[model samples]
Target: MTKWSTIASSLSPDKMFLMKQAMEQLDTRYDEQESMVWGEEGQHDTRESAHYALGLLLRGSLEDVQMASGIIDRVLEMQLTQQGEIYEGTFRASPEQQAPPSGYTAWGTFSPGYGYAQQDALTEVYRRFAQYAQLEEQTQYKEQFGRAADEVFPRVWESFDPNWREFIACTFAVILENFEDRLSIKQVARMDKAMQRAVSTSLERYVSQSIPTNTNIELMHLFIAHYYGHRYEQIDWIQHAERGAMALLDDYRELHSFAEFNSSTYYGVDLTVLGMWRVYGRSVSFRNIGLQLEHGLWEDIAAFYSPAMENICGPFARSYENEITSHSSIGVLLYLALGESKRHLTSINCETSHDLLIALFGVDVPEAALQQLREQQGERFAVRQFKELCERDLPGHNRHVCTATAWLSPQLMIGGLTGSHNTNGQMHHATAHWLDEQGRRYSMRMVRREVGQSWNTHLRGMTFNVETEVSRLDITAHLEAAVPIELVFELEGAALHEIQITADRWQLPGLTVQVDAQAPQPQVIQQGGRAEIVYAVEHRDRIWNQMHFRLYFL
Candidate 1:
């Protein structure tokens, strides 16, 4: 028998029984209440198909392929009608029942959210499949892609739902454009620019009005419209999307905007960051026009499923600690980038709100957190976000993670460095790197602490920033504190000398200067003058306020 089979058999007599049970559930093919959330909009089966499909891609088991392929088949089979309109909403109900607007579908399962659609769900199916098809068999892969190129695009073109229709059509258009490029090359047929404009215009109108968006329905259309607008030089469409996206970020607060909420952070702050990402950080189209939104959108989409990443994708997402709510972590990350965190944000399952604060944009494990992930990963998937972190960046910046984009920071990446516990489960997410000015090196250690509570409720009250140069640095703290214990900073180096400290009168009481190996004592100095050493106590959580420093030659 194979190692997996032998191992399964040895580990538990019930392992085979469990697999059998899963197979039985597969046979029954009953969707859970949770699954219904996705399927209700004709989008469930496709996304599940995508999920299983991704698992299959990683493990590459034939059973996985068949399972994923069959799910995709079921979704395709349950088409609203061959007429390419009127879709199922998980219950297998007919069009007549959906039309009355009972204000509830499934007796209360769904809010008739984002309305109904036919092509949008299937287009998402196409999106997931396309990502999977790369590692898939070229023949069958090409065949499924061929269906998307041929049958799907035409149906998308005919659809009535604005968001899903536009999105699916755009997806199909992108495929056609790509197919022409990859399989057969001829002078590309020009798209109907007016039709494209219509797509983005509708979507932009929806977001501009702060109308319901971020569902399978709205996201699909929005994805298509924004992506293709840029592709075909549709400036007005881009401008329109930009304006609406900006409003969502600048004006909308989760506490104030009841509409700005979702099951996953991906739809809320994540998407907010995404829209912001597309605008400011410049997330470009990886493939077809619409998919720029998918990757960026999906990045936000999957934040809450960190638990799933634990259960499903393994260590790639294991870098997150148990204390941080996925939503909270997402909120903090966004605040680090956006300058404020939205309130009434829901907590992610298997996460607490405290964990969120520690998960800022540039935060990392401090030797203690890593051990926990390893123990968990060791038990399950042997996951390694370290490899991921080194390649991308810690805490997923404007780029997400290090590996997903580029190595973050002037700090050389943790090349080939992995995490394991030393008798105790203490973990560290940092590497020893030289902080230098033309090869002069000083060690910089980043640590995370959540010791004090801020009187201010805004997350801006809880955040701080520190930057290091050759011999000088600036520290900024955001707080509305009576006595914010600002983090104390100093250079305990051998080559360091003549480190002087100074601060404004208001900040003077918070200062205690301790030069190399000196005592931690308060010092008085004129504002704007250099100090031999600087000891500072920043009150917890504030933003955009800084203590300046001017270094002198020894």
Candidate 2:
């Protein structure tokens, strides 16, 4: 560990401290049972804990190895069957049935998607353990891991489409790498054929329908496809992957900037897989492209990070508010530094990071880019990027408008009003988004006109025709009904500014909220500096697109 001075020298002092804090916390967050809680008294989930341990184990500290091994063992012990299929428990007990962990409002359920992810985590941990564990423990765990894979891998392959899950695709890639010879030779051969077929079928089906939404997932598919024995499919999928990567890069380049996309978390997913490709992919040209993209993304991502606050205080065009500035935000710079130099730096700790430190050793990166990373600290660089964020367009399906921020010396405030990115649920009218300095969020939602309305109302699709500027944000909605509706804004520390109503318009700060077929009679109530606005409109056949609205922060 002391030999890592070269790596340590690459990070600024602030990042070094953050890395220390992250790793120390990872040490404490696990219990004696090795269950990972969200906090000291948070709910214990086998899946989340496994992920944490996977990264910790790669830290190569004696204490980390012990903690990670304990977690992997406990996760192996918790696999249970429901409906003739194996799934890891959400807790040590039936977390689904048990009360929520202390201080939590509710418990969690085991979903097929999450179940697939947990199994992937276990297999990944086992893969790493097999490589580095002592002989006897290694053999024992290998046999246990093999049996788990035999049960879960087929089911996971059968139950989920690989195209939809990059996590599983990447997991499959790992299985291909690690499970050989450890399992019964005959079983390994058969499993390989089956997984190869499954991955191929899903890749074909997915490409036929749509381009890959995630770069990381596509890279996994490419890595597997390129090396798979099916030469024709290998070449075919590799071309497909290359095309997709080009398009994604083009999308960002056209904007001349990056959008956080729908979730801030995907940033990590992209970096991790790209880092994996650069490390493991056989082609030099592709690895170089990956390295370039990795460096560019790190620069952009770090620009949002404020070392002063140790948070990603964002002007993200689209992101889940809860994760906007989470303490456990993605470790882009940490991973990039590891990917570039292949030296594992203790100063590069991030809770969600995995075996890339060990796995990607000696992978080459451009000296210029590595030098740039070695020189960065957040606040000064981020302050400049704060200006860039305001000038640039971080577009996402046109569903979310641009972001606006106010940098008040030491504090940063970001806000954006957006509609749902996924259309699986009923159409929401409008969601007003705001994130204050402390990561406190304020979102306002209006119940859709579809509630209690006929299912045919759902046939009426909605679009987000919202717009934004540096100081203001606006949203508009068109409903099938002309009647006035109630809009609810969930507030933390926000207050009402001004509210008024007339026959034709409900007035706020910047614009009017209107519905056709009847004049809107709006009511404004202010309580404790916070306000709620309710208005009624005449019964009309539709709330046309012209019902422009602006949110007023009180």
Candidate 3:
């Protein structure tokens, strides 16, 4: 096991300062919350906050540790109030007092959703707090911690859904291994029962043909089998786990990083879990393979880090907003905390946990890399490109798309194929943008297409070809159906200035023109440097099948 001292003394002064600042910022955020929510206000994810608290306790200062303890205690206290299925969360503020967040909350009004890490964290909180209470000679608090563990155990085990997430399963197995002996005799019996359930569920997931091909899930099943096989003395579990691990090794050899969306976050999550298996698994091969996977993932992720944005700049095949910091933080925690060797310690500032850096990744960054990062931070413009087949399963199988992402200093640009099969219609168009230093997004222009007749049914298998230059973007949309269509070009962003549009060879009768005879007249609506241009074309002609729109940003 790696000691915090080894990592601590080796950290650089500049890196140390940033880590401290991040930890202080996290502490201040929790302090401001009357009760902790998720990253944003009005929402709380059981797992997200739980993991945050785990990171805090593992790497936080004394005060931060105490603060995390209180947060976990509050969660345990909340868990105690439930009688039926274990609801994942509680609204710290009632709707009458503060409006509930719009759309579905994580578990939807405390429904017994997939327990995942929430259940694991609830148990972990009790386990950790009991240790703290014992250290302080607080018999009352120790009893309270134990009692809370018992209160949460049945709910966690009973509500467990095997089909949901593999990481949660890994957490569950670890918890049982660590704390099972400490429980009461009755609780031990309950733990045994839960183990049996996990084995059966895991087996089902392992052998199922229809399950998506995911590296993490596959490796997770192997780890679970290895752990429980020993506990239950089942030879079949061990054999299955070994086979599963070997299969993953083969896939990794071919794919390097296996197919998945949001490589930074998902890969980080998988690597952390693999680190757990490396520590827990008996087979040396599993650990060896895990380390190789770690190196590949780190190299890939580090390339995307833009010191200018202090975030993972993207041509992300599958992307989300808030996970950039969290994903990078998970990597720092796992690699520095557990890896045998501390090679290049790059991308330390990307994580938000100062304590994690000092305790896990290390307090010191390499002088040369640190200098380079600072130098890049001062530069005005930068551009990056990723030209590879990024395979994803969301829209379909073997779905790898060629995409490009560029960072023009404060501006970030991502361009790629539009999502044809997207049910939500969120990413149905080609988009590119740059974020100014203020974190405001500015796009040159965005083109969205709407087919008037049978649009929904006709959308299947459609494709868009986008050609882009330094100062211009041309989008040629192939809509095979001869249906009326409208192309909407929205120039959006806070940094947009002096917005103006002039279309050539296009007739504009208030932006209405026939699809065959003339290009639609561009209707420009401008307000404060943000403008929307609407073009309507509904003529029956073969040319309408291929509609082209060009825009220039000066």
Candidate 4:
């Protein structure tokens, strides 16, 4: 059997199902006339097209290969080739749009962050195209790929960020190790020069700075780079990587959690990078470490996942969206592990499509983790985890962070973090999920609001003392600054009789919330199919720094 088929045969039926479903989804997104995938917003995205091409290449039929080749040709044409320009080496964000020159500042705009084009999009194209050349039997495809490399390799030196630099270097290493015969002397020379630059720059950074553990996704990329550097006999890169990896492993050993703990989006990046190390690392020690970390990470994800609620219980350190149905990279892995019953609860979109690369390279999740996800029903459990935050400026001193007591029962799951130093406002410190009488899932969470600014929901320096029982939660929140806030209860699928409010309490279909602070009356705002019960907490006379509330599951 071919390598892809061999791996496919080894996958469990559920995983195979997930792979097939993902492929079909990609196929549906393809625009036959354009030879690319159109994003949800009706614009053509280069990275999304590259991911679709990779999926098609993996499917590996004659027609699929032809289509994938065409998509790749279109993607390569999108590269910005004007030398001396800021984005010269990067692909365009779209055919009509260039990345914002100011880098990450223009997020949520028509011209978005530079990383989408410069780092992530280019890396995806190069890695996926390299795999295509490796797997195709035809010599013409390999030659075309080599010429494409000639065009792209000279630009690798343009990437300066540690994570992006390492990503390009690792891809170059893979191409050199596997497809050296196809590359011309000029292409190889250019790639090696770029690779050396990345290595030397990385070595200097590692020597001068303490290795960071707080951003778990970027840490994995650095580890992968170190593994490749070691394989290619770069002594300093491997040394620092080994020391950093060992220290990170020690932290996980103590807490059974990551510093960037319980992130629904970034965990997928972590898992994929570990899988790459496990599959590609030549060193046995690195491979073993990857396996160990991957297994532990999977176990943590299983523990937090609620089968009844169809989502992971959070005190999410970072999350882009509140609902699993919106979009989650880890949701792809969960669907693979848990099977078709969860199909409706998970989402796969253009941005997360490249995560399918994990399946292309095999990832072996532990059987124990799989069992936990499958058998979580009718189980009542509680989890407490601790992690340390590295103060980048204050090297030696680390801040201790305690995750909230997560209580999971058959009908409900609730959790929060004791506190967070997250400045990006992605932290969901306290959240609850439960099913109503009609079996529709409902959610509630605490959010900070600036005085007179109801739309402001940035969570920063908020601390919580949260305790959970079988059907109740007691939460006391300490704000760093005195601010008006609200407990926003999402009532998406509720009927009129399912909600009732008294003076200081709220009665929902499945939950009763008792407020302890003097606050304004509750407001119910309806927007389309969704409604929110905004229970506001406002301080008038003096600056009260603390607020207390209780939740009882009915």
Candidate 5:
């Protein structure tokens, strides 16, 4: 085992600080918030959501989890809905009492990622202690866990808001995933259908967005969370994975770019992969999708990695050279395809997508082939890299998941409980994942051929590079600048990374550098005819946070 329990340190110190910054953006109950941005009050998510977070914090420290548990029980008592369903949230305030927010509330909710890390922190602590449910493991931790679970377990279901079904699904996924982690297979097999029903129903409802599922960040971390849990056995989760792959493949074949395949977005194709295939490992059909995509049928998704890798040809051309490394839904499906088809997907560049293709093809490719592929990954790749807003939390270039969320991708984690806004721009999408994960030292790599800039009127990128002997991270550019030239940069400080933008260029966004404390801000890194510009800081710990920019002067 890896010496660390992921749950215990889910939230890095840096993340905790960012969350504090975000919370500060709001008008908490402690503040009257009379003159708030939306000219309103507390946010929509703070009511019952705070309790879960608060309970977790208190549960870890207080010998008696009872205080939090009692509060949880009281909340559950509010759930008039039946055992398996919810129709509303536990916390309620008039719309008049609620203020929307000054900036995008969805983005603001994360502040710097404290709220996000807090969840992981609480979860880790609780899971570690949960095993003491016998109330027998007399460690101080056990007593606290026992008290918390005892009080909360009985009443949590009641407190869950029906309208917040997405959150419910997220909670259920965790419960199930943790149960699997702690219980025997036989024990897991014994969970009644009612539980599954609850999960599926919640996910379906969440994807549909018929209710309030969103908590923040491109819908929230639930999207990534959905993928980590165990796959379905009694059900057809594998089939779902296969179908999603096929549909995406089919769409990519018809459409030149994956950016056009909006169906999978709503259907939660990635989510299904998590819920049914990755954990369960049953989706035999999905293996083919990677094969098809590798065949170069869909350029958009392929652009994320494919031709840029070392492999010159697609997976069909070679297999042995490419190696897939991701545990994501797409990665799992691609591996399935490669194993079935015996193809290899090598990196046209460093992206896992290219890795997926190589795994699918299964061949030893020529170095020349990879060189040729990179040569071809020109402007289209640059544009793909350029069309982003900038995420401050993502340690590197990911602002990845969506073309829509762009820079906000850093706020996204790998689960389904997190969702994004609808086309109408409402933060209505919330998801639930299929698994429970622990640990966070992450490294995400994608392919980019620096398409240089010209006098095109809009600058496509800015440079943000950092490579210390201890830490390695960067957010560079591949500009396909259009009307408004935006200097893109990579910002990493806390544990995560994000993208940052300087609005008018007059006021350079500046802040204290976390990595090299001696590094002064507003210290004249000229861009957009401005001084040092600052970005959103997620946490103050992890003293290595830095922002590297790629200036774009179109």
Candidate 6:
């Protein structure tokens, strides 16, 4: 029951400035006629409109609140109201979108049921606006907010996707804890039943399996749910969450890195959820653990962040955008914590609204992390980190079956997972990043091309070992099948003069590559600013089973 006024006043100067800037950015995106913001895809985005409304509500000015009310009303109208449909109670991604096909699993489209965790932000916006309406004695807005919550609450338990269940449940718990008083008695009863079902299903799933620790952000949401279950005296829910939390903590304690390591987008999610626990956990142990883990994560970010490049040097486990200078959620978080000096490096745009949680709760980045972020220029160094993956060795048991490595240096960063062979499409395996002679940054990552597939995939049976100097990266790849395969190096942000290829080796402005396989010269395919340096491992119409390459970035 914290008030917006209290939260606003409690924000540090840096966060306060960031919040105002984020609000301004969101406000500029608002389309007055449509009562929503046009997204990057040039459509009226329901989720982004809700995020914009939330930022406006947080701003709490007279005109800002009025604009927020309009957006909220429009977004609520976008929710599917047809009973008995697959997406009956869920919101649409866009104004004219329909429910997805019966077998659809892609969550990024304008489909009704694929909003995933992004839709959870709408529930938070409803709760916060409801609270504001009650405080300001705005009766119409209060009723509107209450009805919006009622419309969405029953659907929280409807998602069977394990990847997003905890995220939805965590937001549901927050709504129940904060906005339950505003709901009608019938609505509250329905919500309570839905929550029971949700918790029971979660408990049942984890009974025979270990909790997932690889996706770092959702792991934190599970911990947040555990805290709420303890607060509500739900024994099973509390135990399940506690088990997951301890397992995750123990995993981090072992290697001091998350399985989803060094992500620009998800790192913000990780930090936000951790901040939720740190600020609002019911128990001292929960609060302390949150603080400890948050500090450790900040340290890791600082260690890999290159001030000169203005980006986190990666071997990223998951990444939405390769360049940090683009519109990114992580850049907003960094700007808030690191202050004005980071403004030029930060890309503050509509996506900055993603930092609403951090703005409301506040951030506490450690001084040690801050010092490294501020001073880690012109000093040469190297870093190697190992992360454990959860995989099954036998039925109903999980072990550290795969390990991922990330090696970082002052000028270049390279590394990847040892046993990952499939393409989830986000794994940056065998990745390298360096600054060219003209100080322009470039990224090179290995991708596999199958026989008939036009799109490149991340699938590869490969492993890397970094030498002592960290400037040299050794890669060994094998082919499981006899299909002709080509290991392509996709280079982005390079110009014509920045690369050269010879019969024996390849040279980039910042790194050199040498292959030990008896293959022809590398083929260069250029598409605008991006190029793919393709190395085919086929000889005499038969693909080789194994090949080796070395990258020297010194």
Greater TM-score among 1 and 6 belongs to 6
Backbone clashes in candidate 6 total 0
lDDT of 6 by residue, 230-279 (tens): 75688766666666667767777877877667777677778877877776
Clashing pairs in 6: none
lDDT tens string, model 2, 1-554? 42222333364544444444455566566667535534434556544454555445334456655565555455444433222222221123313322211221111332323423444455557756766665554345766666655543432333322343234335434434532323346544543544455455446434532222233455556555554523335667667656655655665565334444323445555566676667656567667666767666665554444433333443343333323333223533344354423222333333233333323332234555445444434223122211111111112222232333322112322334344332212222233344454444343433334322322121223434344433233556544332223333322234335546444444444334453322234455566544454433323463333345554332
By summed lDDT, which 10 consecutive residues of candidate 2 come out lowest?
Answer: 385-394
Candidate 1: tens digits of C-alpha lDDT, residues 109-167: 22222222223344446546756666553234645654544343322223223333333
Cα lDDT over the full model 3: 0.44
For residue 224, model 2's alpha carbon misses the true position, in angstroms, by: 3.9
Write down the TM-score of every candidate: 0.27, 0.49, 0.51, 0.71, 0.29, 0.71
lDDT of 5 by residue, 384-474 (tens): 2111212122223222223211111111111110111111211111110111122222212111112222221111232222211111112
Number of clashes in every candidate structure?
41, 5, 12, 0, 106, 0
Q: Look at candidate 6 and tell me the lDDT of residue 112.
A: 27
lDDT of 5 at 85: 26
- In order, candidate lDDTs are 0.30, 0.41, 0.44, 0.59, 0.28, 0.59
Q: Show model 3 residue runs off by greater than 4 Å.
A: 1-165, 177-189, 211-216, 326-460, 464-554
Better of 4 and 5 by TM-score: 4
What's model 1's overall lDDT?
Answer: 0.30
Q: Give candidate 4's whole-model lDDT.
A: 0.59
| Candidate 1 ranges beyond 4 A from true positions | 1-44, 58-70, 73-211, 214-221, 228-240, 253-554
Which tens-of-lDDT digit does each residue in 205-317 have in candidate 4? 33433233345534554564575576568776677677777777887889788877777777776776787777776677777877899899988888888876767886676
For candidate 1, the per-residue lDDT at 61 reads 49
lDDT (tens digit, per residue) of candidate 3 on 59-111:
43565455555454443332212222222222122111222122222222332
> Cα miss at 283, model 5 (Å)?
3.0
